[model samples]
Target: MAAGTYQNWRDVADLAMDAIAKDPDAWGDAGAGKNCRSRLIYLYNRRTGQLVRTQIVIQLSAHQSGKSNRIITAYPRGHQC
Candidate 1:
């Protein structure tokens, strides 16, 4: 049976966690500021059922007031700017 349209949330959460644990610098090195954003990329391959170690590019945002940031959006780097 089919469910809602947001089933991939789990996958994304997993990826985000993995990225954070694997490469904390990738997100923190993007820039410096209370309202800065960062990107984390990982290669995904279905044939081997594993990441190709390339880059997925997950864009996240930060705020000056709050201690936490939010995910603005994500995209395939080659497909977008």
Candidate 2:
């Protein structure tokens, strides 16, 4: 039931954890000061039951500030935007 809303959070967490474990210095150190956000995209095939999930990591610009930098702030579907 939980998977209906957010499947890629767990998947992406595992992937990110594994990535950090493999090379801690590479991923963490690179995006320290940078503003970043992660979301999920799901893809399914009609021929197979398996679902393909991916993380959409967006790099926000420094100029986007004052709550305007948030995902819902500029998203077309969001009411706050």
Candidate 3:
């Protein structure tokens, strides 16, 4: 949604999932009271027509028994990758 052109939340979710399936360009701890970790992926922004850096934050403890992780947020950065 930060890109200002996605059709809906579903579209953003799809992109986020794709990014998660690949190796992250960068990643690190998300600090206290936030998701357990964060990852940065370089992805093509359809609206901007450029490769943008997207951030995906995962909350590992949100799910039952740690069976899966929850995406706290996913958005395209204002700058290009």
Maximum-lDDT candidate = 3
lDDT of model 3 at position 56: 49
Deviation from native of the Cα of residue 27 in model 2, angstroms: 15
How much does each candidate deviate from the true structure in C-alpha RMSD?
7.2, 10.7, 5.6
Which residue ranges in model 3 land beyond 4 Å of their true spot?
Answer: 1-9, 33-68, 79-81
With a 3 Å backbone cut-off (N, CA, C), the pairs that clash in candidate 2 are: none
lDDT of 3 by residue, 1-81 (tens): 435443466775665555554644444445443333334544456676776545543322233353336555555544322
Give the TM-score of each candidate. Answer: 0.38, 0.25, 0.40
User: Positional deviation of 76 in candidate 3, in angstroms?
Assistant: 1.2
lDDT of 2 by residue, 1-81 (tens): 124334454554454434333433222111424433333333343346567443333223232443323322111111110
lDDT of 1 by residue, 4-81 (tens): 323264565566545644554444423444232234555455345465454444454554564535544443343212
In the predicted model 3, the residue pairs found to clash are none
Error of 3 at 74 (Å): 0.6
Off by over 4 Å in 1: 1-18, 27-53, 64-66, 78-81
Worst lDDT run of 10 residues, candidate 3, spans 59-68
State which candidate has the highest TM-score.
3
How much lDDT does each candidate structure score? 0.44, 0.33, 0.47
